[model samples]
Target: MRNKLVEFKHVSFRYGDDQPWVLKDCSFCIYENEWVAIIGHNGSGKSTIAKLMNGLLFPQEGEIYINGQLVNDTSIWNIRKDVGMVFQNPDNQFVGTTVQDDVAFGMENRGFAREDMLKRIEQCLHAVGMEAYRLTEPHRLSGGQKQRVAIASVLAISPKILILDEATSMLDPKGRQEILSTVADVQQQHALSLITITHDLNEVTQSERVIVMNEGEVWNEATPRDIFKEKTALRKIGLDVPFVALLTDELREQHIQIDNEPLN
Candidate 1:
């Protein structure tokens, strides 16, 4: 069994004292080095969950534990050290003028020596396959390249857990695919735990677990195969089935004899 890295214990949060709970008694455990996708519609609390994990937002009720340490102010810094985040907009995330400088920004914040900074900068850029453009200005890179730079920046911190909050939603199909491929490569090589908050089921097909939320509550949680089987349940939550899954279901309705399950 995998080690438990993070746990949400009856966690509840709201924007303010007057606001309704954005996350209602949410409880789950994310295992070490697991790639889990949190799926939901807009306002379904997926992004909120990401923020809570990284200490960007504190729970109004209940508790959050990172590596078995409670996420109070005393432990927030250490919790954040282990959990790095990549936001949706690539342009919004860039802090340095050049690609290499961008990747080095996080290391500088963490107080690494200049020599070690340079090494990690190069290593991270190469890991994301953007080493060739080390000196290039951020504006000159494509959308995919900019997102890769963002990923490299996060990876430079040597974080144990990485969260991508709609990181590929703003990109074109090809660009999205490029970023996704880079994420897979990084996870495979580094054993990084990953939490991907996305509406795109296509990107999450191979995720170890799928969590579906609706109206700010965890509506369903299951493996991909089981979740994909609940066509009516998925439709009720205003979520469309994967294209391939829908097609496979159509074939079944027409008496096709294909043995494979939808989008398996």
Candidate 2:
């Protein structure tokens, strides 16, 4: 059996006492080395779940576990060591003047040795195809390059779980594709669990599982192929299936069978 890397049990939360519940009775599991996407339209509580995972925002009514340890005030700091997050706005995430410095910032805080940080930085930058731009200033890079540097910074920390909270939302189509492909390659080289929160159904195609959130609750949880087949169900929750799903159906109608998986 696979080990559970992150688990949410009856989790609920709100920003203020008068605010509406952002997540109510939501529970799910993301397994080790699994790439899971948490998708929903805006205000559907998807991004809220991301903040809760790293203890940036604690649940008001339920328990969150990371590697079996309960998430609380005392455990939050330690939990962060194993959970790294990359937010949507790369501009807000950058601190260092140059690309290499930005990637090394996290390691420096964690007290990684200069020699070791240097080696890891090179490997991570290369992993994200950013090695050639290491000496360039972060502000000068394009949107996709900025996100790649952000990812490399997270990779330096070597967290067990990585959360990309709408990390591609601000990018253009090409930039978005670049970030997604980079993530897929990086994920293949590591054993970490990935939780990507986004509204884009296309982003979830590469995920092992999909957790559909609606109205502050878990609407559904299933493999991408299974979830894609349930077109009506997804539409009811305000999500539209991607073009691939439509193509799949067309091929099916013509009696064509894809011997492999529904998506790559």
Candidate 3:
């Protein structure tokens, strides 16, 4: 059985008393080793949930737990140790001049022994297929290559849960594919729990489960196969289903049977 790595119970958040709630009564759980995708249009509160989970923001109501410990100012530091986040802009996340230094940045902050940092840097860079680029400067690498380095930096810490907050949004189709493939390999090799916050339906198709956020709430939760089945309902909320899903829905409507699940 998978263990619950993260949980939100009736969570609510707002910037201030006068502000409208950004997250309203949101609840969900991400289990260890599960790859879950959180998707919605802009201002859907998906990103807020990501910040909340890491204690970057605290809920005004309800509770969030990471690794069974409640998320609060006091516990946040420790919780973050178990949850690593990579954001959309690869350039923004890079702090090291060279790939090796960037990958070692996180471990260095955590006060890992110099020897340990070197070992982890090597391992993580190899894991992300950037071992050859260890001496390459961040600016010299492509967007996809930089993102892989960012991912490698996060992995150096060995966090149990990895959150990719629109990490692939800025990349081209090929770059996006490369990062997704890297993430899949990292997750499988390390048994890491993955949460991808995205607007892309293609990303959703790769997840074990999907969390649909709409208007500051969790509109629905189901596997990609089942989520795509509700094409009309999804479209109503200003979200587009994948092309394969749309075609499958059309075929099914025409009284044709799809033996295999669409876009699985």
Best by lDDT: 3
Better of 1 and 2 by lDDT: 2
Clashing pairs in 2: none
lDDT of 2 by residue, 1-264 (tens): 889989999999999999999899998998988899999888999888988888889999989999877899999888999998999999999999999999999999999999999999999999999999989999999988999999999999999898999999999988988898788888879887888899989889888899999999998898888888889888887889999878987898899977865573
The order by descending lDDT is 3, 2, 1
Model 3, 1-264: lDDT tens per residue? 889999999999998999999999999999999999999989999889989989989999999999999999799889999999999988899899899999988898899999998888889999999999999899999888888999999999999999999999989888888898899899999999999999777788878999999999999999998998888898899888888777876887899988876454
lDDT against the true structure, per candidate, is: 0.86, 0.90, 0.91
The CA lDDT at 69 in model 2 is: 79
Q: Find the 10 residues in a row with the least total lDDT in model 1.
A: 255-264
Which candidate number maximizes TM-score? Answer: 2
TM-score of 2: 0.96
Relative to the true structure, candidate 3 has a C-alpha RMSD (angstroms) of 2.0
The runs of at least 3 residues in candidate 2 whose Cα sits more than 4 Å from the true structure, single-residue gaps closed, are 257-264
TM-score of each: 0.93, 0.96, 0.94
